[model samples]
Target: MQITIVSGKGGTGKTSLAVSLAMTLENVQLLDADVDEPNCSLFLDLDTKLVAEAKIPIPEINYDLCTLCGACSSNCEYNALMKVPDQILVFEKMCHGCGLCSKICPENAITEVPRTIGYLYEGENKEFLFNFGSLIVGEELSTPVISQLKQLISKDKPIIVIDSPPGSSCPMVETVIDSDYVILVSEPTPFGLSDMKMVVKTLRILEKKFGVVINKDGVGNEELELFCQKEEIPVLLKIPFDLEIAKNYSKGVPFLNVLPEMDSKLKKMIVDIGEALE
Candidate 1:
């Protein structure tokens, strides 16, 4: 079973829940798909090695035999290419590497060159297999990095858990689309509830099976519970707010070690997901 844990926004205990679930389960493969800000490895103690480098093609213009006909610029959906009177400007960071600019160049002046966007690392121990991507600073695109990391996964594993990026954008969608079940982690505050709606909408649009895991459960959690009940969405599990867990997080420790009571609940959540899949 492939399971992805995501949140409506950042700092809502998404990684905490994912790490807890991964540590509680046996022989699971974990992928931290948040290339922009990957912190899952901080809590995991494993012998890690750089497995691969992720790259994307960016346009390289040859000005020798070229005329700035503006065809490439017009064809670019992302506005990555801009044609001035004497020069064509290429914004490497804005480029999606679609190769459309090169194909549409009438003078064949555009060529593609590989640019490194991120590095893929793999780590493992007796319990779980771990892999994550670390995107280069100031790189605007991350889908390619996430794609490369997904390609490196061994699909034969019994359970695969993904720690997805926050929000309902392309990166988050890419991470969750392949999962058999997605656990949307949320806090009890108003901000969490609002963003959760957006994520839930995205999941429905993608036709994905998902449930809610209320993290940092507290006084305002009833609002989230009411919303879930109204939508008829299953409330899978709740990780309560504890100062010790927060302290452990700050010290780069997995909270599962201290909160041993959550182990069975997390295991039961996995079983529930399996049963729902059936």
Candidate 2:
């Protein structure tokens, strides 16, 4: 089963829960889909060997072969191409690789060229396969790179743990789609509750199964619990507000390493999720 651990916003212990669950599960594959800023590997401490580099093949126009007919520029929905009086300019960042400009180019000047967008890495930790992705900085769109990461999931006996992007936007939607279950992590704050509500609405519309995890549980987040009860969403687990956990995380350490108790709790959570699925 592919399980995604996501949060409505950043700094809410989303990656913490994901890494803890990854360390607890036996023979599982971890895929961190927050390509824009993947911090999961920082906590793993394993020397990462390259899995694959993700790239988007964008359309490039050969200026010499172009007649400045403005056809390619007009056909480009992404506005990557612009026609000048004597030449055509192609902005690499604005291109989406749709190939429509190439197909519409009467001068046959457009062709595909590959540029490195991000990379995928895999390494072993204890027994689990730790995998994650890194998006090239300044790359605006992440869905393509995320799709490439999803393709890496093994078909045989694989329990995939996905660390999804924050918020209920396009990137988060793509990351969590078609998952067997989703684990939502949040803190005990008004902001946390509000974002969680947005995420819950999105999940309900998509008709996916998910539960809530209250991180920093003792800091007055009863509203979240009440909201969950009112909405009939499952409250899976509660993690206390521990400064030690935060400090260890800052030093690139998983809570499971310093606090072995996390392993047991995560294992129990996984077991419960498994039973619910069954």
Candidate 3:
């Protein structure tokens, strides 16, 4: 089963929880799908190797065969192509690599070229396998990188834990879209509740089964818990506010190392989720 751990906003302990959960599970694969800023490797000691380079096809115009007929420009939905009087200008950043411009070109001047957008890495120890994607700087498109990273998932692993990007955007959706279950980590604060509500709405639309894990449980009001109760969303686990946990996390330490007592709780939660899936 693939379990994606996500958050509505950043700095909600999403990665921390994901890493801890993966360490707690047996024979699992952990994928960090937050291509723009993958940090799950920081807490693990596995020796990782470069697995693959993530690439996306961008249009390369052949000026010799170009006619500037405006066919490619007119058909481009992303406006990546623009026809000037003298030549056709290709905006590489705006291109979605759909190949529509190349297909519609009258002179066959446009050709697709692979552009390296990110890199995928793989690491394994006795515990579990770890994979992550790192998006190249200045690359606006992350879904392609995430797509490439997910392709590395091993079919032999019984459990896969994905650390998704925060928010309800395309990157997060791409990471969790195929998961068996999603754990939405949120704080109890007002902003946390507001963002979590948006994620809840998005998950409902996608018809995904999910539950909430309230981090820093003691600080915020009970309104978040109340909202979950009203919505009939299961409250899976709560990590209380603790200074030591924050300190350990800042030092690149997994909370499970410091709070070993919570290991049993996490295992129990996974068991409960498995039963629910069955």
Maximum-lDDT candidate: 3
Model 3 spans > 4 angstroms off: none
Off by over 4 Å in 1: none
lDDT of 1 by residue, 29-72 (tens): 99999999998999998878999999999999999957888898
Candidate 1 vs candidate 2: the lDDT winner is: 1
The Cα error of candidate 3 at residue 96, in Å, is 1.2
**1 or 2, which is superior by TM-score?**
1
Q: Please, what is the whole-model Cα lDDT of each candidate in the order they appear?
A: 0.90, 0.85, 0.93
Show where candidate 2 strays beyond 4 Å: 63-65
How do the residues 1-278 of candidate 3 rate in per-residue lDDT, one tens digit apiece?
99999899799988999999999999999999999999999999888999899998999999999988899999899999899999888898898899998888888888999999899999999869999999999989999999989999999999999999999999988998899999999999999999999999999998999999999989979999999999999999999899999999999998889888889999999998998788
Q: Tens-digit lDDT track for model 2 on 79-183?
A: 988888987888988877778888888889888888778898888866677777888889887877888888888776368899999999888898889799999
TM-score of each model, paired residue for residue:
0.96, 0.91, 0.98
Model 2: ten consecutive residues of lowest lDDT: 123-132
Ranking by lDDT: 3, 1, 2
